[model samples]
Target: MNAVGVDVGGTKIAAGVVSPEGEVLAAVRYPTPRSPDKLVETMVRAINEVGSGKDVAGVCLAVPGFVLAQKDTVVFSPNLPAIEGIPLKERVGPEVGFPLTIENDASAAAWGEFRFGSGSGVDDLVFLTLGTGIGGGVISHRALLRGAQGSGGELGHVTVHATGPRCACGNRGCLEALASGTAIGRRAREAAVENPGSALGRLAARRGLLGEDVTELAREGDGVALSVLEETGRWLGIGLAGFVNVFNPEVVAVGGGAMEAGDLILASARREIRLRARPPSRDLVEVKEATLGPESGVLGAAALARNTDGAYALGG
Candidate 1:
């Protein structure tokens, strides 16, 4: 069966019709509106545009923040406050003329990886997206591990440093606070200030640095920029170490914009996991880049979409 998946991000909304084999048959993109009503309207339009003339079984929305799956509502989304509290299924289902389900965006992406990407061959997987903020999801024994309230797999919010920076979620020392794209930018800016003679410093003097800028500088062999990424990677490794010990996943797939640094970041993360995680789990788990890139969200959501009877059309 084919299903429609909508990945709603703070900046853009991407919708796609995906086949059971994981091929995206049709796709559409739109700028996300900040207002609640406009957001709903845009989502409906995106779904219609992508699902038109397709044999779609159901539609699933992959949204950020903490989702209350039973209620089909996003209780909290820091990056996309406009989506918070909206009954997404109720708002989008009738207009799209399909059965709908809601899932945490990270969880959906993890499912996408599990079914078709890095985790395809594994029953146990851990997926993390290091974008503006970190998003995480877990698959254990071939099932998505959503906690009792459907808010589990929030790996980013776990405390990694007791006295680290503040997170957008109002927590301190969270993995998101120390290792996300936002965190990289913040660390880069501070590094630029400390090493005013470096390439990173030269760029920061002209314009504010973003995570991408840090990656670019690192690629040019700028020592300060490389150091920034190394530090971020170590923090990421610290967090991954904890997860490796706890979940013992066969694969830990890292995705999103920050991962553009690739091994520059992951090499250190691997080192930290080896140092801190238990021997068996650390030795067994493979930490690698997620292959689907930005498409993981929509693909995962589509894969997880369910029928009217709540059966997954394309099982995870």
Candidate 2:
């Protein structure tokens, strides 16, 4: 059967009709509206646009922040604050004319990897996306491990350093505060100040540095930028080491915009895993880049959806 998956992000909304085989049959994208009413309208329009004239059995929305699966409500989304407190199912189900469900974006992405991407061959998997913030999910024994409130698998909030920087979540020393793309930019600015004559320093003097700028500078062989990525990677590795011990996942797939740095970030993470993670688990885990890239959320949500006439369950 085919289903529609909608990745409702802070910046844009991506909706697609996907086949049972994980192929996207039709897709649409639109800039996300901030207002509650416009947001719902755009979402309905996107779903109808892709689902029109198709044999789509259901629809699933992949949204950010803490999601209460049973209630189909977004409790809090730091990036998309407008989505918070919205009764998604009640607002969207009738308009869409299909069985609808919701899942955390990162968890949905992990399911996408489990079914079609990096974790396809593994029974246990860990997925992380390092963007402006870090988002994560865990799949254990072929099941998505959503906590009681359906807000589990929040790997990014785990503290890697007790006395480190403050996170956007107001926590101290969270992995997101150290290893996310935003962290990279923050570190890059500090590095620029320390290395005034380096390429990174020059760029910072000309304009503000973003995470992508750091990667580009590193690609151009700038030592300061390279160091910044190295620092971020080590912090990521510190976090990964803990996950390796706890989840013992066969595959840890890293994705999102920051992954454009490729091996530059992962190589250090692997090294730290070896240094800090325990023997058997660390030896077995393979940390790799997620193959599904940006499409993972949509693909995973589509896979999780069910026909209107059939039963639908959140998580596994």
Candidate 3:
């Protein structure tokens, strides 16, 4: 049987027809609409477009927010605010006309990695997504861990420092505030302003840039740019060390745009994870980049549907 997975992101909505074996058979993408109703319409169109000629078993949506399991309402979403507290099942159920499931985007990605990507074969694992902001998912004993309120595994919000930068969650020193791509970019821009002679400054001068651009320059041997990445990686490691102590997962799978910097970022993170994490957890957990890349969200949502019977189960 086939399943339809939709990745409802801040900028775009992507849907794909996924087979039981995790292969994407068909895919469609569209800009996400602003309003809740229009967003649902856009998602439905994408689902129908990709699933038109395929035999679909169910539909799964991977959204970024605190999902109320029993109610299937998106309680809060920082990126897509208009849909917060909206009845997702009621809005999309009839339009899709099939069993539906909803999952947090990070959790969906973790499921994808656990089933078919880098974390495959690992019973306990953590999946960290380094996008504009940080997001994470935890899998323990071959099952996804959704906490008491279906809001577990929010590693991004984990406090990394007592007196650090403020976060969108209205907290100080969150992992996301310190090490996310946006954070890295903000720091890079500040560095460019401070040191005009540095390679990062020159690059920023030629074109107003951010973390990705700095990473590209570093790949070409830019010292200042490399330093920015190293700093971000170090902060990332600091956060992972805390995660290691708490979850003790078998593997830490890093995904998203930041990992594109390759060793420029991973080398620093690996060094810190080894230095700070407890020996047993450090030895038990392996830090690796995600193999599924951008497709993880949709693929994992498909995996959720393929494994479950279309019911949204928080912990099964």
Candidate 4:
């Protein structure tokens, strides 16, 4: 039987029908609704569209928030404030009429990688997603590590610098604050402003934006953009070293738009991790890019639903 996976993001909600082998059979997407009620309705529509006339066994949802494993309530999410503390399982359960499992987006992505992507052969792995912000997940011995209070694997909040920059979470010097996509864009904008003659400035001016344009400029050998990416990569490496030392996972999968800069970003991260991490840990971990790209979360969520127990049990 197939499963339905819903990936709820700040901008859009994507639902897909997935097979046990990780192939997506059909997908439906729509802009995320603003209110909590509308969001649920939108999700239901997407689920129905993809699940119609199919033998869907269950549904899995990946949301960006602190989810209570037992209740499937979104305790808090900086991006989706309107849905804070919303009981997801209770709200959508009756409508979908299938066992539903919910997980943090990052965790779902990691599970997706573990079951179907690059981390398939590894028992221990760390997943760092570099999107609007940094998010992370951890797996050990083929099981997820959902720490006390069900908020484990928050790799973005790990402190990399004590006096760096302020984060959206109201924390200072967090890894996300220093090396996220937002951080990269912010730094590139600053660099363009400070160096009007640089290629980055020209690209930003032409594109009317600072993100991918700047990264593209860096790939084209723009000095200012290169510097920004290098700095961002260094911060990511510093943060990754901590994880390397602590978890000693066999593989580290880096995913997200920022990684599209290719060696401009990852090369520096690899260098930094090699320089700072312990010999044994560094030697054991193989840092690589995520192969599933943007589909990892949904694929993983579907995988979760497919593998869940006979009937969906809310909290483990």
Candidate 5:
């Protein structure tokens, strides 16, 4: 039977039904509700929307926060404050209409990549999502490590600048604060406002600009946009350098909507990683773009469900 995968983000919940061979059959999305109860209701609704009345072997949820899959709990979620420490299984099971599993959103994406995407068959790999906020998942020794506290690859929270902007996690200089899509947009907007006559500013002055817009501008060779992306890549490189030094992953797969920058974002990240990391480790690692695109989270969530302890439970 197919499994249902739901990727719950700060703003939306994207759900899909996936075949055992990794094909997405049906998909749906809904705005995330604010209240904890409403969140569960929304998820149940989303699951049924995509599940299409099939008896799903399991339904997996990829949540943005610290997920304790063993206990089926969301320890903390800065974006979804109401659900912090909420017992997910206890709250979401009754209405979900099927067995369920929960996992960290980034970890889910990493698992998806490892199973069928860029890092497939790789024993050691790293996955980073450069979307609303930077997130990460890692695989070492051919196993997913969620750490003792189940937050192993929260690489975005790693400090990149000691006195940089404050992050949502209440910390200063985190990678998420520095290199995330939001960060790039923030920098782009600032540039557009400060120098409206420049190429990047002209594009921004026409309408509101997003991180993707900046990438588009960079692709067109807009000077300001290129500069902003280069800076963004620098931070990514600095943060990833630390990972390379530590994990020595064979491949680093970058994903998320913002990663659409393609060569603009990745090329810079690769260059910076090579410059900052040590010889063999830096030379050995290959940073590549994830092929799964937006569906990665949902697919990985399905993997989490199908491979949970009963499936492939990866509790550290």
Candidate 6:
């Protein structure tokens, strides 16, 4: 069966028609509007473009933030604020004119990977997305770990350090406050401002330092940039240490734009996990880059939509 998936991000909405085998048949990208209603319109527009005015078996929308227990509404999202408190599935389904499933973007990506990408065949696994903010999803024994409150894998909100940096989640020392792309960019920008002659600083002088810039600089052996990533890795490793202890997953797939740094981030995180996480389990889990790249969310969303059970269940 074919299904349509929409991944709603702060900057863009990615919509796609996906085959049962996880192939993306058709896709479209639309700019995200600032207004909540317009955002729904954009999502519907993308669906129409990818659906080609044809009805699919199901539709799914993947969004960031804490989704409500009902899954039809977004409880809160630090990244995409407009949709907060909005009943997305209810609002979108009428205009979309179909059954709809909604899930956290991170969960969607993890499900996509478990079903079709790097984590395939794995009974237990974790997925961490290092984007503007951190996003997380966990699968235990082949089931998506949706907690009683539907916020089980909100790894970004986990406090990695006491009295550490403040997170957008109204907390101090959240993992997202330390290891996210936003954190890396902040560190790099600070480094550039302090040391204008350095490689990272030179790039920052040209344009603002982005997480990618730090990664590229670190790759080129820029000491400051490398240090910043190493710190981030260590922070991630510490956070992963807790996840490893709790979930005991077979693998942890780290994805998102910042992962372009590849081994630079993984190596440090591995080191920290090894140092911090308990013995056997820490050694058991391997951290790898997510294979599906940017398409994981949409692919997973499509998979959710194609589910046999009416296809609109929240937190499925």
Q: What is candidate 3's CA lDDT for residue 7?
A: 89
lDDT of 5 by residue, 1-316 (tens): 6788899989899999887778888999999999988988898899988876765788888888877766877787777786677788888877767778777989988988887799986899999998889889999987877988677789899999999998988999999998898899889999898889888888777888877778777888788899888889889989999999999999999888778887787777888888889978998999989989888898888877753337642211
Worst 10 residues of 2 by lDDT: 307-316
Q: What are the C-alpha RMSDs, in order, of all predicted structures?
A: 1.0, 1.8, 2.2, 2.3, 2.4, 2.3
- In model 1, which runs have C-alpha deviations exceeding 4 angstroms? none
Q: What is the TM-score of each candidate against the true structure?
A: 0.98, 0.96, 0.95, 0.95, 0.92, 0.94
Which of the two, 4 or 5, has more lDDT?
A: 4
**What lDDT does each candidate get?**
0.93, 0.91, 0.85, 0.85, 0.84, 0.86
For candidate 4, the per-residue lDDT at 103 reads 82
Clashes of 5: 5
- What TM-score does prediction 2 earn? 0.96
Name the weakest run of 10 consecutive residues (lDDT summed) in model 4: 307-316
Total backbone clashes of model 2?
0
Q: For this target, which candidate reaches the highest TM-score against the unseen true structure?
A: 1
The sequence of per-residue lDDT tens digits that candidate 1 reaches over residues 15-43 is: 99999999999999999999999999999
- lDDT of model 2 at position 263: 88
Query: Which model is ahead, 3 or 6, in terms of TM-score?
Result: 3
Clashing pairs in 5: 307-311, 307-312, 308-312, 308-313, 309-313
lDDT of 2 by residue, 50-122 (tens): 9999987889999989999788999888778899989999999999898998889989899999998999978
Q: TM-score: which is higher, 1 or 4?
A: 1
Clashing pairs in 3: none
Per residue, candidate 6 scores C-alpha lDDT tens digits across 6-111 of 8989899999988888888899998889898898889889987888755477888899899885657888899889989888767887786667777889998998
Regions more than 4 Å wrong, model 2: 309-316
Q: Give the distance in Å from residue 315's predicted Cα in candidate 1 to where it truly belongs.
A: 2.8
Model 4 C-alpha lDDT versus the unseen true structure:
0.85
Ranking by lDDT: 1, 2, 6, 4, 3, 5
Cα deviation at 95, candidate 5, in Å, is 2.5
